[model samples]
Target: MRSNFRVALIAGSIVLSQVFAVTASAAPSAHPERSSLVEDIRFKVEKFQLDNGLTVILHEDHSAPIYSYHQWFRVGPRHEDPRRTGLAHFFEHLMFKGTDKYPGKKWERIIQANGGSNNAFTSRDYTGYYEDMPSGTLELIIDIESDRMRNLNMKQDEIDSEREVVKEERRFRVENSIIGAMYEALFSTVFKVHNYRWPVIGSMTHLNATKREEFKAFYDQFYAPNNSVVVVVGAFDSGDAKKWIKKYYGDYKKSEIPAETSKKEPVQRGQRSVTLRRAVQSPTVMVGFQAPKAGHDDAYAFDLLSNILSNGNSSRLYNRLVYREQRATSISSWAYTAQEAGIFNITSELKPGQDVDRSLMSIYGEVYKLRNGLVSEAELEKAKNQVMTDTVNQLRTVSGKARALAAAEIIYGDYSAVFTDLDKYNKVTREQIQNVAKSYLKPEQRSVIRMLPKE
Candidate 1:
């Protein structure tokens, strides 16, 4: 799923595009007692496991009469074989086609009758489905979700139709958008061994080649109760929620989930680059560096450094490249974290007739200065404040809190990390930031993608 959360900056007259999913928004002010807030949030959360190995997490919020119910499965594009790249994502669409009990359009009609909305998204690491409904409708959503989890009746015709729908989605999102194409190219060139090298939306050839049996095998393998997490947030009683979860999900049997033995991506020994000629208005350059995994200590420092470089107009890259030099129209930097190792990326859209080489040098110069410990104490403080404030803002929403809890559990193996991670960010020192920059942001460890306007 593409994350709705992002931290952004505007450079000169141009606005930088958001570089990462799972980012935070601007906050009113930094909360000094963030630990208390974390504790408060933790207190409201209730977690338990069902006999069938189904994991359930619940959060009660009486402020509103609405709630969000989400189910996150540990299957995504990363679980697919190289030849069958898009099956995981394609199944996301097929899931909505309905089971025998619910049938076509029946599930959606029931949700609409109750004035609720439902949707799902697939990412490289997980697939998530959620429903936001008025509090009274929680049981209804749970029943529908639980029914489909084990009883989905897939038809050959539905698969055929949805396959085309996925193809059209790819056409709109990746094939037609310059930035989208650049993102695909960036990962493809960055990793040689990992499945992350492929986009979440599988290629047209693979989608067309997939068979119905393959689809059934995938569903049976990864969609088991043991391989998923169920989260419910908003106005609800924890006890009632658990009872409902057990009633609907307890009887489902856990299947034998297979172990993932994908080859580990080897270390990069030199800079890699790819050039794409797209029909666009301006030339865009994207640079990526191999970075630490999500739970790693240095990831926090990298996150802070990304904010310092491009979180706002006052950021280093915005002021340097957009205002001071006026060579680039916009620039953004982000450290993307996943279940495995992540990518730290910087992207710039250059002005007409600007020197790409010169812009690259200017950006690298600023980065090298960070390695040299030129970051002042004030700048470091500002970055920290932004990170903390963003965290507070994210926790303010029910869906946001639920997503954080689910992602933390699925990706990091600890839901408490959702709260403790802020402290990790707070503990990051200027020295650590400089050290990470020196260690990972080296010339040989980077990849460059230049998208030139097609002649």
Candidate 2:
């Protein structure tokens, strides 16, 4: 889920300049380069489970008066019944609507009056609600969250109203957005059996058809302590925070959850592609190649592969397709690290009058070549260092640290997975990068989508 976990950006304009530095071989280390100065990474965490089986992690950082509160639910669109494709996303919006204990909009008003900010997000694997506010008001924050979890008041009027809001959101985020449209089409065609094919924001068609009763049923099924994690980070005492948490959330009943193991996708027999036409500015192509999930050993190498290919302007896809080949105006790629499975995406926004098919072929050719040839040790190190720097910087901010720990604990089953992840990354050899490519980057494993400008 997008959640409140932020990927912090430090002052790296100098590093940004080297975005077009991709080469047939890696550059020598002797080239003058300056590492961005980063703050110390430190967090004091208290981990425990409540009587009802709610997992909680608290990070005490008194550096500032503000704190970040997050409640991450393990269940997301993956757990949703196929009939309720967008229920998770819908619930995300409705959570802000008041509950029985705190009726009307008074709950949010109370928090805002106390100087706080809040938002939530839904992904394929998780839905997270979070708030950032002054540390002194931590109890109020917990109170608000606890009330909503157990005492949500879902009136038929509110449900009908919010459903329309969700439909409009889909129109804005999916129907109108070109890349968003491409993402939906690509994933739908790519994953045969996996629930990943369904977009988290859900289908407007399904949302409109959903009954009020079904929405309440969805809330009961997934919104429980057993499937959630509460993370509070910033200036606070862990002991006091835990005491208040129990006082507020201890009464929430544990609900029985269904055993959830879904059928995995079979090996790809061949390449897949889709086309989306809309009133867009330029022709765009999205290419996806299936890869291992986040914790899989291959995930680290795939991440490095993404960094080398398209992490920044200096990366291969950008430098080659945009600057060197001049195939399109801009080119970029992303290695999406989702919960269960992932994809390496190369996106090219074509130059006016440029051939989209030609650009797509050239980009695919580079990935194919990488599979056949081993990347140099120098290239591998460059990618590794780049990721390390980003990771360290992400942990520097208080909010960042909290999010890192929270995501690690909820997503990977332990906060230590964050550090362990780095260790695994450090052990990746250049050969492993080539191996993942050879195994996962075959042309047949790809799903290509071209979003063309409306005629």
Candidate 3:
């Protein structure tokens, strides 16, 4: 349900490709634009645990004949043993390698017969599996998922095969892309002790070093039914889905999950900087400011600040850096919206021969002005409207709703948060937004990265 969140500067190139032209809606907005705090936007959510402790949530949406099956596990790089940096993401690939009961071919046959597609991803906080299929094929989807969850076919040979595959994935994604290389270097230098510094795709060296026994150990520790959430969305009888889930998943036993007792990162005392050299035509600059978690009150204000500075062509950074100043081919900012503590970042790709230092200073000037003065009421209104419009539009498709439900439930711990969380954005004021900028966007709390063309 969550968006693919990379570092702000790097994510800009990809996010920009998704033409997010937020045109104002013409018809009267049926629902109240303002969030109604007391009224929970409850779907027909029924929760149950199988005999083995797998948590299942069923929400019946009969808008169409298709269904989305989403499964989320409470493990990610954050939960990995310090030495096991990419284990979570590595396991994400292994999960699809076919189980004993559902070998790769058999699993594909069922999915192909049912007109469904499936994929999985791993993040810092969680890993997720999802399938979109015809509503009538619920049983096939359930069977495949249950089999893999309990009985994975982890062989030494298969692990070796997937490790090479994952290595090439890292090469393609991190080694090839200019910005991706920059992020790998940036995070490596940025977080001295936090697990957050490790790339989610994992290191090729670590992936190769991971033993098959390690995979089994990881599965036993975190892949229990109790530590996972099953999300079913689309046209279906809720009662029927629940019965099928219990029958298929009930026998799995939940073990006592191990606690994650990693070293907590101490507050950073000073600014840090790093440089990356890539064989690219243009240079790029990135600035990351440590910010609050997604649940914090100030987070909403920071989200608004991100939009005001770089959400669109009309945003301040876009206008200043790319349009007026003509220093950058593009400029953007993002509040790394995460459930855990995250980064507020700005990125700019320099126009040929542009002064990087001057461009960086200009960007700083924009932040200084915001911290010193209130954003205009009109600007605040536009940002709020943009957030509302985007939220409503995301639910326009069944697959999108399913993704939203899975993400909200797994990350925020509440599916109802899809609607309730909007309140934070609605209630943000100009002064509060300015105050947050001043509080969190200080030089001492930030990191700077510059990627230059290889000399």
**Shift in Å, residue 265, candidate 1:** 1.8
Stretches of candidate 3 off by over 4 Å are 1-3, 6-21, 26-42
Q: Which runs in model 2 stand beyond 4 Å of their true positions?
A: 1-42
Backbone clash tally for model 1? Answer: 2
Q: Give the winner by lDDT: 1 or 2.
A: 1
Model 1, 1-455: lDDT tens digits are 11122211111000011222333355332343454434533546778888778888888988889888889898888789888898888878888988988975999999999999888877678888888889888777889999989888889999998988999989997898777888889888888888779988899899889999999999998898999999888998887888888889989999888788566788899999999997777789988888776778887888888888887888888899999999898898877766776778899999988888899999898888888875777887777766666566567677767777777777766677777766676677889999999999998988999999788
Q: Rank the candidates by TM-score, best first.
A: 1, 3, 2
Sorted on lDDT, best first, the list reads: 1, 3, 2
lDDT of each: 0.78, 0.73, 0.73
TM-score of each: 0.92, 0.90, 0.92
Pairs in clash, predicted candidate 1: 1-122, 1-123
Tens digits of per-residue lDDT for model 3 on 74-125?
8888788777678888888788878888887788788888788888877677
lDDT of 2 by residue, 238-353 (tens): 87899999999898899888777656878787988787888777798988877676677887777778777876677777778888888878776655556677666777899877
CA shift of 409, model 1, Å: 0.9
